[model samples]
Target chain A: AQTVTQSQPEMSVQEAETVTLSCTYDTSESDYYLFWYKQPPSRQMILVIRQEAYKQQNATENRFSVNFQKAAKSFSLKISDSQLGDAAMYFCAYRSAPSGTYKYIFGTGTRLKVLA
Target chain B: DAGVTQSPTHLIKTRGQQVTLRCSPKSGHDTVSWYQQALGQGPQFIFQYYEEEERQRGNFPDRFSGHQFPNYSSELNVNALLLGDSALYLCASSLNSYEQYFGPGTRLTVT
Candidate 1:
C-alpha cells in the first residue's frame, strides 16, 4: 500500500512572497509520478505541476516548482511570488507508473492563505 | 476544448435512498475515473473505467457501482446512501494514463 502525507494543515504567505508546502510519500515501487493539485472555493481541482520519479531534475510550472528527493521520499511545492489567487487547498498525489495501477493516492491537503 | 464535465452540480438526497451521478469525459479522453472527497479531506479513488469496463477500484463497498457507456461517459450509482456518503464526487479523464483533467465535481449531500 502507498500513502501520501502533507504535514502542513494550513499555511499563510504574504502576497508577492514565497512559500513552500511539504509532502512525503511511502511507496515500494521505483517508478511512479507525483503531482500537486489546487482546489479553490469554486470546487474545481486544477493541476499545478507534476514530477516523474525517474527524473532527477525537479518539475517547474511558472511560479510553482517541486523539490523531489527520491531517497528521502519527500516532494515539496514551492510557490514563488504568491498571489491572492493562489489561496486554496493544495493536495499532493502519487500514482504508479508504466504497468501499475492508474489510481491516485492523495494527501490530506494543506490550505494556503495568501495575505495581502 | 472543454474539460471534464459533471451533471447536477449539486444534489441532495435522503439517507437510505439511491443516487446517480453522471460524468462526461474531456474531449478525446477514453478513460474516466471517479473520486470521493469529504469535507476538508483529500479525494479518495472510487474506481476507473476504460473500454466500457471497470479496470481499477478502491476500498469502497459494493453499494457503490458504476458504468461506462460506449461514448466513454460514465455514471456512479450509490445505493442505500449513508450520511458518510455525502461529499464532492469528482470525475477525471485522461488519455492512456496521462495527466488527468478533473471536472468541477458534483456535490452530493446526504441527509
Candidate 2:
C-alpha cells in the first residue's frame, strides 16, 4: 500500500517571502507521479505543480516548485514570494502508473497562512 | 473550458438514511473518480469509473457504491450512513488516467 505523509500541520509565511512544505511517501512502485494541490476557503482544489518519479529534474510552475528525491521518497513544495492568496490547505498526492491501481494517495495536508 | 461540476453543493441526512451525490466530468473527459474528504484531512479516493464501468476502488466498504453514465457523469451512493460518513465528496475527471481535474465538491452531513 502507498501512503503519503505531511509532517507539518500548519505553516505561516510573510508576504513576499518564501516557504517550504515537507511531504514524504512510502511506495514500492518505481514509476509514479507526485502532485501538490491547494484548497482555499472557497473549498476549491487547485493543482499547484507535479513531478514525475523518473525525472531527476524537479517541476516548477510559476511561484511553486517541488524538490523531489525519489531515493528518499521525499517531495516538498516551495512557494517563492508567497502572497496572501497563497493561504490555503496544501495537499501532497501520489498517483501510480498504468500498471498499478492509479488511485491517488494524499497526505493529511498542511494549512498555509501568508502573513501580510 | 468548464471544469468538473458537482450537484447539491451541500446535503444533510440522518443516520441510517441513504445519500446520492452527482458529478459531471469536464468537457472531453471520459473517466470519473470519487473521493471523500473528512474535515481537516486530505481527500481519500473512493472509486473510479471508465467506459461506464467501475475500474478501481479504494479501501472503503461495500456500503459505498457508484455508477457512471454514458455521458461521463457519475453518482456516488452511500447506504446505512453513519455520523462518520459526514464529509466533503469530490469528483475528478481525467483523460488517459493521467492528471485529473477536480470539482468543487459536495458537502455531506449525517446527523
Candidate 3:
C-alpha cells in the first residue's frame, strides 16, 4: 500500500541552469529504497539516481542529486547545469526492502523541458 | 554487455484478443520484472519472475500472466485484452540487488 507522488506535472529550465523536481511518498516500512527514472521521447526508461532510506547522506550522481527528507516523506531530484538532452519524462519510484517484495510503486511522471 | 532487450518493439491487438511480449534480461541477471506504462503515466509493476517461478505480483487481474524460462528470459501474456490495456510494457532485469536495468519497452496498442 505504498504510493509515490510527483506534484509537478511539467517543468522547464534554460540550458546551463539548474532544475529541481519534487516527489513525495507514503510508506509504512522503515527500510526501503527510492529511485528516479528518466524516459525520453524514445520511450526508454533510464535510471537517474537512487537513495536508500537508511542512508542519511543524500545520493549524488554527477549532475543528478536527490534531496531525501525521510521524515518529511520527500525525495526531490536536482539536475545541475541542465542540457537539452536532459529533457524527458521523470518518474519517482518506491520499493520495499523485505524479501519476496519486488513491487515498485511509481509516481505520475513530470515532463522536463530544457530550453536552449 | 547489452542491457535488457524486448522483442517486437510494437504490437497491435484488438479487444478480446490475446498477446504475448518477450524479454531477455541483461547478462548475468537472473531476475526479471514486468511493468505497464500507460500514456502520460508512470510504469506500474505487473509481476516479477525468478528461478523460473513467479515471486511477486501486483494488483493486476488473472488475465495478466507470465512465465520465465530457464535462461532467465521472460514473457508477459495478456488474455482478452481491453482498450485500457494499451500501454508501454517494460522489462527490467536485476541480480540480488535492488537496482534494476530496464529494456526499451514494447508499445502495445489495443484497439
User: Residue A16's C-alpha lDDT in candidate 2?
Assistant: 99
| lDDT winner, 2 or 3 | 3
DockQ of candidate 3?
A: 0.84
Instruction: Give a tens-digit lDDT track for model 2, residues B81-100.
Output: 99999999999999878888
Arrange candidates by DockQ, descending: 1, 3, 2
User: What lDDT, from 0 to 1, does candidate 1 have?
Assistant: 0.97
Is candidate 2 or 3 superior in DockQ? 3
* Clash pairs for candidate 2: none
Q: Candidate 3, chain A: TM-score? A: 0.99
Instruction: List where candidate 3 sits over 4 angstroms from the true fold.
Output: none
| lDDT per residue as tens, model 1, A9-90 | 9999999999999999999989999999999999999999999999999999999999999999999999999999999999
> Model 3 misses residue A60 by how many Å?
0.6
TM-score of chain B of each: 0.98, 0.98, 0.98
Error of 2 at A7 (Å): 0.2
The sequence of per-residue lDDT tens digits that candidate 1 reaches over residues B22-67 is 9999999999999999999999999999999999999999999999
Model 2 ranges off by over 4 Å: none
Superposed by TM-score, candidate 2 places the C-alpha of residue B64 at a distance from the truth, in angstroms, of 0.9
Worst 10 residues of 3 chain A by lDDT: A96-105
For all candidates in order, the CA lDDT equals: 0.97, 0.94, 0.95
Q: Which DockQ value does candidate 2 get? A: 0.81
